[model samples]
Target: MQLRQMTDPNLILFDVEAESKEQVIKQLVSKLAKEDYLESEQPFLEAVLQREEVSPTGMERGLAIPHGKSTAVKKAAFAVARLKTPLEDWESIDPTNKVQLVFLIAIPTNEGGSTHLEVLSTLSTNLMRDGYMEGLMATNSKEEFLSRLDIEEKVKSNSDKKYDKTVVAITACATGIAHTYMAAEALEKAGHELGVNVLVEKQGANGIEDELTPSVIEKADAVIFATDIAPKQKERFAGKSYVQTRVAEPLRQAKEMIQKALSNPDGVVEENDSEEASQSSSSSNGSGGFLKDAVQAVMTGISYMIPVIVAAGLMMGIAKLGAMPFGLVNELHEAKYATHSNELFVILHHLDKFGVLIFKFMYPIFAAFVAYSLADRVGLVAGFIGGAFAGGLHHTFWGIEGIPSGFLGALILGLAAGYISRFLNQKIQLSKNFQAMKPMFLIPAISVLSTFFLNFYVIDPVFGGLNVVLRNWIESAQGTGDVVLASIIASATAFDLGGPINKAAGAIAIGLAADQVYPLTARVLAIVIPPIGLGLATVIDKYVVGRRVFEADLRVAGNTALLLGFIAISEGAIPFMLRNPLITIPINIIGAIVGASTAVLLGAVQWLPLPAFWGWPLVDNLWAYLLGLVVGASFIAFANIFIRFAMIKKRELAA
Candidate 1:
């Protein structure tokens, strides 16, 4: 089918008002769905975003080509949107351009074989032609615009021009869709202008094109390695002078990069292990490809947040355990703290209070780092602001004294801040003298304000309402029976290991405990059970199956998990969940539920922050608590082992 067959007038939106690139994509994707171009919008949207994480599609002269391959798309199509406000932080190869136009292409993940390459190639070539984009901008009607998509020849270089220097270049990208060709065309165009003979070997999804022979490499004076990943056969240029950069760098600086390669940039070609060094230099030298994935950004945030969680929990645990001997600890009967005249009690009370203070900023820290991951230092201030809102810092302003949104809130705000700050940094055009104001003043102020607006109108209200509903349910659940309450809390805690859902459960349970709704017995035990259980399973797997069931590294993780579990850190079990999430998650939930329910039925009560062994003395029924813990952990351990053994036996029988 022709390019225009994929685009309907209904899919072409004009004068769309959106502040960010994400909003624009969603708006267009929604339109595509309304026009029956997609079976579902979210999966396709996610695919497009995944492509974005690999490398931003924004190009020079106010254009962005964001495409995705997904089963959610019923048909391959292109949608165009002309935005009223230029999206600044779209991460266009040319950082200076504010993206006013977007070409969002949807390719069916399963059916996008050659059709995918054809669409991307046609669009990329049409864009490369002289005045193609400018012509589209002048079109007032959708039909006028659609007609522009007709087949067109690529902008040609002067073939008759003579050159003294010959540069052989390689262009590659993670997707190998649009960028590979775009970079090649840019290099050729630059060579034509500079009177240098440039031959490009494209390493793409379709494999290498215009393959470089030994003769070409031998004759060339310099080489340009423009790629996101390591180029194939890089050793061919080991002894030759080379310049390394990312794929998109050529879009804006093709001439400068070609010139630099001719100069033989230092540190790229070292004496020892020169090929490896050159490859490493090429990867590191590029400013792009640093933002790996959204999940990685979240994990990075979680990693940074983990130490804070552990420290706050440990401090609170110590204070609770220390105050127990002197009868200074608060119980259901006593609403007072451990602020007794004894110096130790007073010190412990102060420490407990300090822990609460530290816990308050946990969400904000999680958010700030996540933003830092996505948008670098520019996202820090905005992320911190968003996280503070997520943490319910404006409780007085909102007039709601309940639990904060916790991890979920932090994640949302962190990502939002990163996108906003990054966008403003890229979009806002400033002159040389005032450019310093962009990052130091303009970006932070605007991003923070935008984040505040989002939380004020949306996040706080929604989460606060959810909190109210959750609190009422907890009170109602406790009225009927402790079993119901314990099961629910324990299940939620074990659900995602250390994900936002776990934090959400923690927020509600801890808030209720503070208000004396129910003891923390279920919450604390549930937190420890999964890690301990997973650890035990790892230890017994080989014995149960007469062969190693898990990888060697998992066994090491098992040892660490066992120790961490005893100390009430649920994050230690995260490795197991990540490896086999579908089975592991359900098993963990069941184990936690059984353990917490058993503890409740046996009258094991603990309302304090002490989740570790040190707090056993403070528990109302220590024997019942111990039995429940063992029963839950053992159930999880044995169940996991049995399932693994069955799988192993089945495989052997089949063999």
Candidate 2:
């Protein structure tokens, strides 16, 4: 449908008097509601505001396209307005440009397919034309404005020129918002100027638009992938000569990149090689490039593994509660198992066993997904086999008996499995008829077999031995006044929130619990302190620094942190940490150390692996645990408040 068809005369507002962007949006939404285009205003307004937070839609030449897709929208519609006064401080790519023309678009939230995207693309393209925008702005009335929108002008093509290159490109960004479409536009404009035929596909918030067909890809002279993350179905570009770079690069230097691609076609690396190098090069400036990638892979695994952990942990906690009626709590804690004459107790014991069964596979799932992220589907079997082997699934592989390799070994084997599968994928290419069987049989058989032997003979022995040594050291530190060890565990657990290091500490704690180490006081405190501390920081900020500094989203985040913190999810603090890592991270670490050390010194004991507030009743020396949380959270609150006040003062002085 045409852009003009989506709007009505009643939806158009002339000489709109709005002082701020919020007022402008509210006015437009009110109009939309009045016109029966929106069923509810609040939800639609919230969705639009949330989108604005990610990146503002204010474009160049006094234009702003504020849009939202939600169930609150009764129909796809547009509301146009001409502001009587320009609003300052609205986020725009060009800060000097004050927006005068507003186009508010409302789309159905559940609308399947790329209908909204098509409309957006068309509207954005037309807005780029100086004549089209000027004509619309010149309209004196709603009918005139609608008439101006109906006057479509044909875009002259430069296809008559004899250009040798036919380029196909894909553009994507992390959020798949403004930059994705902007890059596509830039590249297309550049292609037109250069008299080269270019087909640009946009992978944006709505999904892929103008997707490249196999025939188009096969006929293209070169491919350009502009993305911050790896493109989906990346294997499609496997054999094609391609230029890969960050999404923003095209917006900045599209002509230069295109020229370079045309000139040096042979220089374009294979898809896998380019991706690996891209990942490496992006982090090359830092010494921790490999470490960051490894952490990212593990964190990907952790995010997927969390639901399993929570479910199993809660089940075990309930089982403990069930055993209490039979007076078998202490016995179950000691023996890690119990039998009772009561049928209810028997069922609880079975539930505990079932939870344990699911829990044991956590690391394996972690390993498999980590590999999948790295090498896609081919890595699944290999990663799972490697992780299972690490978990001591086949202790006597080839008559070489070994211990369970634990999390450390799982980490190593997971990466190895991914790389192994990646290597196989790169090397092997079957005929078309046999290609379908490769992923199902050939790749899995070879990758799993290789990973199995490697883990059993090499990785397991080395990491398994180191794992034993580390556990013994930690065990030895227990009951001793080993402040250093306690502090280290606490710091590591809080360092990355729920990233690799935190997960590593958690894995160790869980392992120890399985081994009949009833009281993992320090580790449990570490898990709870960071999130609680950060939540306290937000509360303190509201009182000391004022709510204006928190913004709408940060306030929402702060509220979320409190609930998540109570549930022992340290990841709740990640947004705060990311905002001011220098200040927030150090404060979190200090709070974690204080809480963990206090818990250990006070002899707080926790039998269950569950970390939620509901499990507090199961802790030994419960008062001490609560006291540690209060003390550490207080430290975080005070420190955070002071730091924020100082920063705000500094900014004011600079202003």
Task: Return the top candidate by lDDT.
Answer: 1
Go through the candidates in order and give each one's C-alpha lDDT.
Answer: 0.74, 0.69
TM-score computed on alpha carbons, candidate 2: 0.66
Residue range with the least summed lDDT across 10 consecutive positions in model 2: 276-285
| Tens-digit per-residue lDDT, 401-449, candidate 1 | 6555555667778888877765665467667667567677888889999
Clashing pairs in 2: none
Q: Any idea how many clashes model 2 has? A: 0
Name the regions of candidate 1 deviating beyond 4 angstroms: 1-292, 317-341, 396-400, 472-485, 492-524, 527-588, 599-624, 634-655
Candidates' TM-scores?
Answer: 0.46, 0.66
lDDT of 1 at 285: 38
Q: Please name the candidate that would achieve the greatest TM-score relative to the true structure.
A: 2
